[model samples]
Target chain A: MSRLIRGNAVSADDWTELDDATAVPSTAKVIVSLARWRAERETLAAATAIGVRVDNSADIQTLWPELRDLPLVALEFPKSGDGRAFSQARLLREHCGYQGEIRAIGDVQRDHLQAMQRCGFDAFVPRDDQDLDDCLRALHEFDLAYQRAARDDLPLVWRLRRQA
Target chain B: MYRYDEYDQKLVDERVAQFRDQTRRFLAGQLGEDEFRALRLRNGLYIQRFAPMLRIAIPYGLLSAAQMRMLAHIARKYDKGYGHFTTRQNIQFNWPKLPEVPDLLADLATVQMHAIQTSGNCIRNITADHLAGVANDELVDPRPYCELTRQWSSFHPEFNWLPRKFKFAFSASLNDRAATRVHDIGVHLVKNDAGELGYTIYVGGGLGRMPMLGHKIREFLPEVDLFSYLEAILRIYNLQGRRDNIHRARIKVLVKALGPEKFIELVEAEWAQIKDSYLKLLPQDIERMKGRFDVPAYVDETAADDGSYTAKLAADSKFAAWAKRNLRAHVRPGYAAVFVSLKANGVAPGDVTDAQMDALADLAEQYSFSELRATHDQNLVLADVARKDMYALWQRLSELGLATPNIGLLTDLICCPGLDFCSLANAGSIGVAQDIFDRFEDFDYQHDIGEIKLKMSGCMNGCGHHTVGHIGILGVDKSGEEWYQVTLGGSAENDAALGDRTGPSFSRADIAPAIEKIIQVYLEQRDGAEESFLHTYRRVGMGPFKARLYAKVSAETEVAA
Candidate 1:
C-alpha cells in the first residue's frame, strides 16, 4: 500500500510483472513483476510473492521463502518516499542472494538511485522517456560509503585505511 | 579540554569545504529548493519563523575557552549577538543567514568545531552528566565513552539516513542524571563482577508526540562489542523501520510493535553477522581517546583551608550562601566544581550573550583548568576550579552576572524557546519562564523552598523536558491567548516518571499564584527541608496540589465546598 504513487500509470496496489507471485494466474494475469520476484522474497518477508505479480497478504508467511530461488527479481517503487521496496530489494540481493536482473520499476527517479544502488539493486528500469545519462551519473556519484551496504562490502572507513 | 587530533582536523576541514561547494551549487540554481532543503539541514541550517536558524553542536557540551571565543566570534560576526542553549546541551543561533552558513562553518572549523549532525535525522551530539570527570559520586568518568560515541556516530554512513534523529546518552553512576530512560539509546557503563566495564543498553525511548521510555534491549553488552551492537541495531531499524509514515518512524514505535524480545533476536542475529569486523572496538583506539581525558593536575588541600573560607563566610553571608549552593566536591583536593548559572531571573534559560561567553571562556582559561560544561538544566559548569580561588572566581563571575549561585533552586529552570523562535510552538514559553524566575528571586526564600524542578515547554513536544520536572508547566494557546498548564511530581532521576497535569489550565497571571498556593500547601503540611519537594509531593497525593490549583474555580462551580 505504501508504493501507491500518482503519475502517468503506476499505483502501489498495482504490482509490476514479477513483484508478486499469484496462485490464481487466470484471475490476475494482467500484473507481473519483472525478473520474477517469486524466488528471492522469503515468506518471513511479511508480504507474499504470488504467481508472476500480486501476492496475497496471508500467503506472505509461506510464499516468501518459496520464491527465494527465482532467477529474475523485479522490485517495485510505487512512490518516491515509500521505502518498503528498499527492504524488498535488499532481502533479494543480500539474504536471498538473487544474482539475476533486479530491475527498479515504477517511480525510479535519478535521485533515489543512490539508496537503491546502496541497498543492492543492480539494474534500473526507468520510464521510457527518462534520461539514462542522469541515471548513470547517480550510479557513479559517491564512490565511498561508511556503512556496510548490500552492494559494496568495503565501508568508507576501511577504504580510507586501505588508501593510507 | 581535548585537543583535536589529525583525524578530527581533517574530517572537519573536508566537511567545511564540501559544504562550501554545496552552498555554491545551490546559489547557482543547480540544486532546487527541495533538494537543497535536506542538504542545508545536514549542514545544521534551518529556515525558521524569523530567519535561518543554525544549530551548533556543543558535543557533550564540552568546549575549551579558545573554542568558545571562536563561537563568540561567530555570533558577533555572523549571527545577531546571542545564542540559545538547547535542552539537549547544544546551542542555536536564531538569525544566521543561509548564505553565510558556509563561512560560519569555516570559522568554526578554524577552532576545530563544525555543526555537522547537529540537526537532521542523524546521530545528535552525545551528552552525559555535566559533572562528568569531577562529580564526587561518579563511578568512572563518562567523558571518554562520550567522546568515543561522539567520534563513532559522527557522519556514520549506514545510520546517517535513519528514520528519525537518534539521541544517545551515557551515565556511569547509580544516579541517572543523564536522563538515560528518555533517550533513543541509553548506555549505563558499569563495572561487572570481573572488574570489567560493560553496558546495559536501552533502546526506543524518545520524547515527542509519542513519549515512551526505552526498554532494556541488551544487558551486560561488553564494552568491546559496543559499536558493532549499535550498528546492528541501526541496520535492523533502517531495514525494517517503517519509513512510510514519519510519525511512526522512530525506533520506539517499531520496538513497541515488534516487541522487545523479537527486536533483541533480530539485533543479535544482525550483530552475529557483523561482529569481530572492523567496527569492533580496538583496545588501543579506546586507550588513545581515554589518554587525552587524563585527570587534570590537582594540588593537595584540606576542607579547613587556612580558616580563610570560614573567614569569608563570617565577613559575608551572601558569599557563604552562594558557596553553600554553587560549590560541590570535585573528586580532587583543593579543587571544586563551580556551577555558573545561566538561569538568571527574567532571562531566557541557557542563553548567554557573546560578551558573556567570551568572559566565561576567559574565566575558564584563567581559573577553571580550561574546561567548562553545559549542564542539562541549561547552566554552565566549571568542572575544575581551585578551592583557594573561589572568592576570585565568584568576583569575576558575579561581575558578568554569571554567578547567580542558584544551581538547583527556583531560578535554575529548564524552559523551551517557544513561539518566539519556533513556528511549531503554540504559546510563548519565554515570557512564562521569565515570570517564574523573576517571581522567585529571594535567595532565602528560594533556599528554604528546597530543591524543586520547574520545567516549562511551549507545547507537549517536551523540549523543556516538562515531563521530568517537579513543577511542570506546559503552554497551551486557547483562542489566540496563552494559558499555562501545570503538572506535578515528575522526575528524571533513577526514579524517573512523567508529571501528571492537574484538572485545567490557568491564565498566565494566575500561574505563579497557583504554584505559590501549591508550595504553601506543601510548606504547611510537609515535614522538613530535608524531605525534597518531589519526595514530599509524591508521599502525599496530587490531591492537595490539584485541590489548591482548582480551589477558586471549584468554589465557583459548587455552591458550597
Candidate 2:
C-alpha cells in the first residue's frame, strides 16, 4: 500500500487496482488496465465507482468519448525517467475535458510532484519508500509559473497585466 | 541584452538553492548516480572525460560588458583560467569539480546568468543570428523573440523531460547566420502580404547520428500564435516520439516516421484545442517583451565624413586587408560590426583566456555600445562599432593576437572539443584543426583561395556542425588509429544542404593534403575568383574533386614506393 496525496491532503485511498485476470467487483472503487476496461466497458462502466489505468505507450486519445465519465483516470510512469504521462495528463484535461480525479501512479517521486500537478494530476500515489510530507512539500517548490496549467487558469503574463 | 526582472531573478535564485540541495543529497548518498545525473544535467552540468563541464547560457549570444567580466571572473575562480564558446552560443567550463558546481551556479546567477537547460533533454539555449539587430538586411530584430522563447521554455512543466534534446533557432535576416534550417525547430520571421509580421515555422531538423533538414510546416504563423503553436508541436512530439531507442528518439525521427502531412495534421488538432487558451500571446505581451530589447541610442552621423577611414584604409595595406575580412556592413550609417577572431593560429578555435576575455570586455565598452555577441562561428562581435574607431580597435586587437584576419577563411574552422575533452569523441579534433592551421598559415594564400568554411567533428554527433560545412571532415576510428572522412558542397545558409561524402577516408597525416588537393581542384576548375568554393563545387559537381583527391593519394603512394 502507498500513501495517496489528493489535492493537497493525505487521503485514505479506497480505490483498488485490479489486474486483467481479476474479476470486476460491482460495489467497490476498482481501477483496471486500459485493455481490461476496453474489453469489459459495459460491465466496468456500470460499477458504483470505477477508474482506468493507462500505460505510457497507450494511445490516450482513444480513451476519450468512450471512457469520459470515469470517476478517476490514473496515468502510469513506468520509470522515473519516462515522461509520457505528463503529455497524457495534459491531453486528458485540455483535449478530452475530463475533470475527474487524475492520479499519477507507478514510480512517482517527490521531484515529479510539482510537474505532475501542473499537468492536471489531482492525486499522486508516490513510490512506497518516499515520505508523504516530503512529497507534499514538493508541490510548493515554485510560487509562480509562466505557463497556464490545470491549477492556474491564467498564465503569469496575463496575471501580471491585470495586477499592473 | 535582456535584463532579468525580479520574477526572473527569483526563479534563478530558487533554482540555485534547489540544485545545492540536490548536490548535497547526491554527495551524502541519499540519491543514486543515475538519479543525480538527470538532476545535474537539467542544470547544465555534464560529466565529460577529463572533468565536469558546465555550459553557461548566453541567451541568444547577447552579453553586456558586466556579464563578460563575470564570465572572466568565473573562469579564473572556478576551473582552468579559460572557457570555450560553443556553436549554440553558450560557453563551457571544462574543469569544474563536482562538489563545487552548486557554488559555481550560484556565482553565475549573481550576474543574471545560469546554466539551466544548457544541456540535457530540454529546449537548449535559443540561438539567434550574431548580427541580429545591427545587420543591414535584417527584417526584424530576433532578440525579442529569442528572449520570449527562452522564458517560455525555461523549466517548462510538460516539455522539460523530452524524449530527446530540443534546439530552437530564430533568424530574421536575408542571410541565415543562425543556421535555422539545421535546428530542431527553426523560426524565420517573415512579413505577410498585408505587411503583418509572422513566422515561417520549420520542424524536425537536427544533426547527430542522423542529420536531416527541418521541413517547413507552417508558411506563415501569425506572431500572436507563437507560443500556442510551439506548445502544440512539443506536446505531440513528447507523446509520439520514439522512446524505445535513444538514437531514434529526436523529433526528427518521429516527424520522419509519420510523414510531414500526418505530423502537421496532429499538430493542427492539438493547436485547435489550445489556440484560444491563455497560452496565446496578447498584443500587450508582445509589446512588453519587445520593450525589453530597447535599441541602443545612436548619434546621427553622416557618411560623408568617412574620408579619414578611407585614407587610413588606403595608406595601410595590412589595415585594408583586415578591414576587408573582419568588418561587416551595419544597419546604421558610419558604423561597422567588428568580428574579433578567436581562431588565432595555436589556440583552440573558440577557447579564450581569462585575460583575453577581460580585454575583450574592456574593448567592448570602449568601442562598441558596451555590448558584445558570441557568434555561432566561435568568435566575438562588437556589433555597433563606429567606422572611425576601426583603426584603433584593429591595432588593439592585433596587439592581443586577436587580429587574425581569417574570418570565413579555410583556417577559420569550427571544431568540437573532441577526445581530449569529450568522452563521446572517437578522436581528437583540435589536433587536426591545428595541423590544418599550420598547413594554411599564409595570409596571402588564404586570401587567394577565398571564403571556405571547414568544419570538423570528432564523432558522428556533429557538434562542430561538420555535416553543413563547405569542406566537412568527420573523424573516425578504424581499429585504434584516427582516420578522417571528408565531404563536399554542404552549406548552412539559406540554401542549406547536407554534405555528400567524398571518395575514401584518409589517415590523419593525409587529411590536410586531401583538403589541399580538393582546394587545388576548385582553384583549377573555378571560372573566376568570384566563385566561392561551395559555388564552384555546386556548379561543376563533386566528380572532378573526388577524382583528383583519390588519384593524388594513389600517385603519392606509388612515388613513395
> What TM-score would every model get versus the actual structure?
0.86, 0.97
Compose the digit string of candidate 1's lDDT tens values, residues B1-561: 667765677778777876786688679876557656766777788889999989888887888888888878888988878888888888889998878888899889888787888877678889888888887788888888888788777755445566777889889887888888888899899877898888889998877667778899987888888888987787778667776687888889899999999999999987886677766776765677787774676666764244566678789877888899998887877777889988877678888999999998999888777778887889888888876678878888888888887888877889888999887788888888777766777888888988888888898778888878888888888999889888888887788787887879999888878878888888866887788888888898888887777878977879764
Give the alpha carbon lDDT tens digit for every residue of B26-144 in model 2.
89887778778988999999999989999999999999888899899989999789999998889999999989999998988898999999988888999999999999889999989
Q: Which candidate ranks first by DockQ, i.e. highest?
A: 2
What DockQ do the predictions score, one after another?
0.14, 0.59
lDDT of 2 at B18: 84
lDDT of 1: 0.74
Chain B TM-scores, listed for every candidate in order, come to 0.96, 0.98
